[model samples]
Target: MTAVLFFLFAAAALAGALGVVLSRNPVHSALWLVLTLLSVAVFFLLQSAQLVAAVQVIVYAGAIVVLFLFVIMLLGVDREETLSDPIKLQRPAAIVLGVLMLGEVLVLAGHEWATGAQTAHGVPIHGLMDTGTDPGNNIERVARVLFTDFLWPFQLTAALLVVAVIGAIVLARRSGERPEDPGPGIPAAERARPGSGSGERPEADAETSEGTS
Candidate 1:
């Protein structure tokens, strides 16, 4: 039944989200994120919104998750960090915000259910729902509403994303300017010239002794 399928997908999404938070390795976290995104796409499918589901799967699960994995792998950030919290009151603040968001969602869901409309908690909040059409409408209607009704905000979002991308690039370049910290496998002396092999310093010492003798 649809109800059973909905619960199953919802459970999967919740589990995946928890896995993303609890997994120590960044790569594992990214995989869990893919699971969560895929489950959300399934939610769209259950609502008969095939286009949204396909976009969710392709853009989020496929491209975005792969990009996350690539960054974790390439940047050598797969290792776990210390468990100590860096910011003061961060955990308590996050818990408060999460509780507030959950309360808001519950209230909206209850309101929509009481209204008995297929609005899905006022999904297209900018305008009224098109009760005349079935749930299987394609993305054309969504696109039209986005461009016509929300064009300025959409353009602002695009500019913000562009600024974020530039900021990330600048940060990455700045980080690269600093010398890399020594890893467990690297000796303090060799960290400066990791390419010079493990015997490099000893060979230099031998050469200096021979020259003195």
Candidate 2:
């Protein structure tokens, strides 16, 4: 049953990952990424890592992805016209990197499987839950190392993320507020609609002048 569940989630993860890469729309790609993250959380649950699974769902899928969607919304860049690939070599480079990653994954998987098979009878693979008295040993140990040795780096990463989000918001708002050029001597308001300003519509001003006289 465990093996069956693992394979199911593994397939879902793979499909979701492929969808993320293939989807043209950024929003659709982000939704596909949620699917991939959820599948990974399920895998963590199957491994008895409940804390990791919770963080995977709550922190990544919930907070981070929602923040991503917020930035996407703010940018308002979903139009098909704006979807052109600026860098010509980006697609080819991504394909090459993806292929290399796949090769590495295959090699690691084969090595682990062979080692596990060889030790199947003599030794058992003990996970964090099995080795320690505390059921939350994996999470605790990770938190210890993260907060102790990697605390500064972790805080720096968080600060960088915050700065990036602020920068995106500022750029989006600045672009939105910028007025398009409407030729020489055109008032910004009059440019919004033809003949709607004092200078643009002289006939209306002249009529008012005659009425006043």
Candidate 3:
């Protein structure tokens, strides 16, 4: 039954991941991302890692996806842009990198993969699987290994996130600046104010005799 559930969620995760890439609508892509994240949390649950699963659901699915949706909506979902690729060799580079990543997955699949031991950078819920005495054993053990063993990498990730946030704020400050032309749909009075000389807008009344009269 465990294997059955695992395969089911694994399929769902893969489908959701594909949907995220293939879906044209940003909102639909974000919903697909939520499914992928939830499936990953289920993977942790299958390993009896409740804390890690909760964090995955809460942090990635809840917070990160919400932020993504917020940004998508704020940028105006109705707006469309040209689908042309702006960067050179982008498609080829993506294909190459994707193939390399697939090769890595196949390599790992051939190896004997197990939990309850330290992963490449992060440790699993070994404490939970080993001892039933302590309720917070999983939390304590994982936190200790993460802080001591993978502290530098964690710090680097945090610094990168901080830098991204700062860059977003700087860009947001420029959103208010727009073109001076209102682009149609304005009252005649607002467009042409009284007591203003024709020199203020030579283009507006170029053929009229108001200024010449």
Candidate 4:
């Protein structure tokens, strides 16, 4: 059952990753990323790392992906008129790369799962719940190392993420706001129609029509 689940989620993770790369729409790519993150969280669960799985879902899928979507919406890129592949031999190249990636994954699967697998503190994290005395060992260990040893690096990464968000805002501001564009609730055609802005204008026009009649 474990093996079956592992393969299933591994396939899903691969598919999600491909979608993230192949998707032209930024929002679609972000949603694909969420699939990949969820698949990874499942892997952590299989490894008996509940806290890691929870963080993987909450921090990465929840917070980070939300931030990405927010930034993408703020950028507000216009959609392409055509979806055809513009580059020559793009499809062929993608197929070749995909086959190579599949071969690599197969090769890695043949080897022991322990090969090059370790936590940030170089501790092996294969089966924490199965081996550890306390059920909360994973959380305790992670918090200790994260706060004591890797705190500075963690804080730096967070600061960089904030900087990236601010940079996106700055870029959006440079593009300038399109105040002329109608709000989401209002139809653009309705906003542009003559005498739509003021109720008094319509009433005055009706009075003039009556007088002329």
- Candidate 2 — which residues are off by over 4 angstroms? 80-97, 108-136, 151-213
Residue 50, candidate 1: C-alpha displacement in angstroms: 2.8
TM-score for each predicted model, relative to the true structure: 0.59, 0.57, 0.58, 0.57
User: Candidate 4's C-alpha lDDT?
Assistant: 0.70
* Arranged by TM-score, best first: 1, 3, 4, 2
Off by over 4 Å in 3: 78-101, 108-136, 147-164, 179-213
> Which lDDT tens digits does candidate 1 get at residues 35-148?
899999887776656678899999898888887876677678889867888999998899999999999988876874656776565563221223236343457767777899
- lDDT tens digits, residues 157-198, model 2? 999987775454333321213454333443455545543343
lDDT (tens digit, per residue) of candidate 4 on 1-213 = 677788899999999999998788888899999999999999998888789899889999999999788767765852443677799899899899989999999878555563554343354445435636553577787787789999999999999987765554333321113344332333445445633443333433334333432
Instruction: Write candidate 3's Cα lDDT for 124-166 as tens digits.
Output: 3342255445555678867877899999999999999976755
Query: Best candidate per TM-score, number?
Result: 1
Report residue 109 deviation for candidate 3 (angstroms): 4.7
What's the lDDT for all of these models?
0.69, 0.70, 0.70, 0.70
* CA error at residue 171 for candidate 2, angstroms: 5.3
Q: What's the residue-level lDDT of 86 in candidate 4?
A: 98
> By TM-score, how accurate is candidate 1?
0.59
Pick by TM-score: 1 or 4, better one? 1
Top model by lDDT, which number?
Answer: 4
Task: Pick the winner on lDDT between candidates 1 and 4.
Answer: 4
